[model samples]
Target: MTATTVDMEVRGPWSLATGRAFWEGFAPAALPAARGDDLTTVLLVEADWSRAEASVAQDGGTAAITVDGDGDLDAAAAQVARFLALDVDATFWPAVGERDPVIAEVQAGLPGLRPCGFHSPYEAAAWAVLSQRIRIPQAATLRSQLTDRHGDRGAFPAPAVLRGLELDLPGRKAEYLRAVADAALDGLLDGLALRSVPPEEAIRLVQQVKGIGPFAAELVVVRGANAPDAVPHHERRLDDEITARYGDGATVDSVSAAWRPFRTWAAVHLRAAREGRLHEFG
Candidate 1:
């Protein structure tokens, strides 16, 4: 089939370089791997339950998306936008840094860094199930095995594909994963639907799925839906960074007030800096 291509205008400061950096190192096992100049991954077009392979690259003020699949190309494009956070209109993101020197410092180090997220909430919830009570590397192995055995190309299996599977897994993870798949099939985990609601509400909705706790729910809403302004109430790393930069008395609520609509961006920058994922973290 001929590949469908689209060029989407980016609303704020963006750099493909920063995005590639995040894709390559941040949760390599859970997210798409950045290859060469393009970030390629298979997207499940929820509209019709078909798979599309998509390649995304930066083109001036736009993101150029090339997709190869039989599914809905328009849906594929929209999902790509959300995954890369291109859907966010962050034209005013820089002003947040200007108001806070701490944010300003990280912004200088990691310019045009947007919060990249899971392809969809379904995938993130599956990850939440696979990663429970286990180290990331181990969970990554399990995910790879599942994808290699059941996924098309490198795409994670669709919910319909995942729900019927029965296999050996630690504890009741397989059961929980099936539950997650059920939620996806029911449209409870639809990315657009989840993104339309408040992050707190989204978290509440996701937590209704079995084996998903507050922390996991946060991942589904904040990272999965890619909410720009959602405050991560449970991220210990952000709390540590907050105290490190703003003294021992500083807290997520106290300092995050200044972050306003770009709280997620600020928090991601701080975490990236701490993990030395950016070129210059100082």
Candidate 2:
């Protein structure tokens, strides 16, 4: 089988290292080791999955994608584009950053930050369910267990592989995983179609799947589609986040209103702040 290559033009500030760090920082074992200048991962294109590699050009305006398989190259390129969020225009992010001191600071520090999506919406949706009620490390552990039991070498378990496993996860979580796998197999939760929808509708559509609630659905939109407006409602650490954003008394709704289309980025900033790792980007 011949390998396919594509030079994809992308808008906005993008750093391969930044995107890779955003992915593996919290969960190093999610898929495989995404390291170095090229972030490589497995992606399914049409009916086949391949190891997809994406790297930034010297100009920082293009990503060269190489898929090592006979899979549909066009589909693979599109998938890489979605995963790297190449379509997001950060031109206005600086201006948006000016509205709030904290965001302004975060934006300045993380110069080429781009929100990284999962390999597919189905994977993100299933991941939300699997991680619910567990700490990040525990969730990563379970994910590792599942993949180790059923995944291909250095790849997440394929949908077909997941369809037969009755893991000892919580009943709803296990059922949700299987249901999402079936959805992925049936093409209902393909990344392209879902990524094209409004965040609200995407949340509504994914909620139709079993065991997906409002929080989980919205998380999918944020992670799966890179919906900028999605806020993780009910998230703790708001006071510290509030102080970090707008000094002592600012509320989430009041201050976040200024962030409009980039609220998802704000959420990540807040999380990083709470964990005391804002200096990583700063």
Candidate 3:
């Protein structure tokens, strides 16, 4: 396939090099070529349901993307931007550190780090289903099995494909996966729609799906839609981190006010730091 290539301007302080560390460690859905400085992956463009082999590398303020597929190139580029958080204008992210010392330390530790997310809300929902009640390693193995059996290349299966399959997964996960696919096809899982509203509203809406609950809904909205400012209210680890970093009286509501509109970034940073410093290790 002839590749359709484009160069996208990434706003604010960003680095594929620094962000690669997190991607390499992110286990829900392993990123392609995450071991390298550049990012290479097979993306399932939700706009037209076309599969593309995409490679992205950073040069200064721009992300150069080369895509080989028969889908909408514009949509592909936009999806790539969302996936890598290039669409977010994080120029003032550094300023968030000035207010909070912990944030400052985390920023200093993981400079130029942007939270990379699932390719789309559809995939995130699918992962939420797969991961429930299972260890990450087991879930990852199941995801790999599903991909090998049904996905195009390494991309997760399209909605129609996933919906049609009678998967042999544990519990009622297969039923839940179909429900997720149904939501995706019905536009309930569109990234734009999910990200357009308040994070709370998005979570509420996503929970309407059969298998999605508060935790899964938050996963879809905050990480799946890649809402830059969304807070993970249900994350126990974040709560623990807050108590450990701040005082025992510290709470997410009290401390996160300092985080402001970049709350998601702060939350991800805290989690990464708590999870053994992916930035430094990788």
Candidate 3: tens digits of C-alpha lDDT, residues 1-282 = 667778888888898877776776788865655455688878899898889888889989998988888888778878888877888999889889999999999988888889886889999999999999998888889988998899998888999999999888899999999999999999999998987899889999999999999989988888888888888888987899899999889888889888888999999888878876433311
Q: Give the TM-score of candidate 2.
A: 0.84
**Candidate 1 lDDT tens digits, 30-49:** 34454587777776666666
Rank by TM-score, highest first.
Answer: 3, 1, 2
CA deviation > 4 Å runs, candidate 3: 32-36, 277-282
Decide which is better by lDDT, 1 or 3.
3
lDDT of each: 0.83, 0.67, 0.86
Ranking of all predicted structures according to lDDT, beginning with the best and ending with the worst: 3, 1, 2
Q: Mark the regions of model 2 whose C-alpha exceeds 4 Å error after superposition.
A: 28-36, 45-58, 237-240, 276-282
**Which has the greatest TM-score?**
3
TM-score of every candidate relative to the true structure: 0.94, 0.84, 0.95
Write model 2 residue lDDT over 18-128, tens digit each, in one string.
666666564623334544567777654534554444333424687777766555666767676766677666666666678877787876666677767566676677778
Residue pairs in candidate 1 whose N, alpha carbon or C atoms collide under 3 angstroms: none
